[model samples]
Target: MKIIRSRDFTGSHAWEALDIASMNGITTRLHWTDQPYRWHVNDGEEVFVVLDGEIQMRYRENGQEQVAVLKVGDIFYASVGTEHVAHPLGVARVLVVESKGSV
Candidate 1:
């Protein structure tokens, strides 16, 4: 097991690293300080779990829409192949889990 502080690094509004996983999934923990960034899609689906503070999930919908406001213990999932931008209502930390499998 490993523990990481979101701001343990420098020049970053957020911090994240892969902890442990094998063949099944990958788990990552990230911390943000009321600063949300745009999410770039690559591969696999991702689930964001809010660890602290509040985060507002945003997505493009012709105009713009507020997906939802997530707080501590709140869980949200985003599908692959989409662009998203998250805005922090307050200092926020989140654990992001991504995996590739079908079952």
Candidate 2:
């Protein structure tokens, strides 16, 4: 068993992550970022949880672009084939769960 303080985590680069756990082909990770992630579709489903700070989540739907402001405790679910990206307002910590090796 392990305990993590999300607010105490930081990375040397954007989107750097701490591997938390892996179960049944899925992986849970804690990420620290001050930059945006590239827009891409996951191979499977993805669950994004804001642990600290805020994020501007941009996604595509029906060929249109949309955005959602996600703050602490907010969660974003991305199903297969869903294209999305995350832009942090500043330094942010996020918990992400998705299939192993998913992009």
Candidate 3:
């Protein structure tokens, strides 16, 4: 068993993640970032939870770009084929759960 204090986590680069656990083919990770992630589609579904700070989540739907403001405690769900990116308002910690090896 392990205990993690998400607010206390930091990384040297954007989107650097700390592996938490893996079950079946899925993995859970804690990420720290102050920059935006490149747009990409996950190989499977994804669950993004904001642990601290705020994020501007951008996505494309029906060929139109959209954005969502995700604050601490907000959750974002991305289904397969959903092209999306995350832009942190500042330093942020996020918990992400998705298939192993997914980008």
Candidate 4:
């Protein structure tokens, strides 16, 4: 087992992730970002948890785009075929749980 301090983490680039665990084709990772991510659809389900700072989560539903502001401790769930992207307000740390190679 390993202990991680999410607030103390940083990445070389936006959306760079540190792998935390993988079990039964599911992967858990920590991501650091200060920029926005491109919109994309996941092949499977995804669980996004904010660890530090804030994020503006944009998603497309029924051909419409919507946004949600997520703060620390907030969780966002994305099911298969859900097109979404994340825009961090500044520097943010996030924990993401999803199927292996789902991106």
Give the better candidate number (1 or 2) by lDDT.
2
Model 1 segments beyond 4 Å from truth?
1-12, 15-25, 61-64, 99-103
Q: How far off is residue 14 in model 4, in Å? A: 0.7
The candidate with the higher lDDT, 3 or 4, is: 3
TM-score of each: 0.65, 0.99, 0.98, 0.97
Taking the tens digit of each residue's C-alpha lDDT, what string does model 2 give over 14-90?
Answer: 99999999999999999999999999999999999999999999999999999999999999999999999999999
Better of 2 and 4 by lDDT: 2
**Where is model 1 poorest over a 10-residue stretch in terms of lDDT?**
9-18
Q: Each model's C-alpha lDDT?
A: 0.63, 0.98, 0.98, 0.96
What does each candidate score in C-alpha RMSD?
A: 4.9, 0.4, 0.5, 0.6
The weakest ten consecutive residues by lDDT in model 2 span: 3-12
- Model 4 weakest lDDT span, ten residues long: 1-10
> How far in Å is the alpha carbon of 35 misplaced in model 2?
0.3
Model 1: per-residue Cα lDDT over 1-103, one tens digit each? 6655653532344533334344545545354555667656637777888877788887655556548888888987777755566677866667667764311
Q: In candidate 4, residue 44 scores what lDDT?
A: 95
Q: Supply the TM-score for candidate 4.
A: 0.97
Candidate 1 local lDDT, residue 91: 62
In Å, residue 3's CA in model 1 sits off its true spot by: 6.6
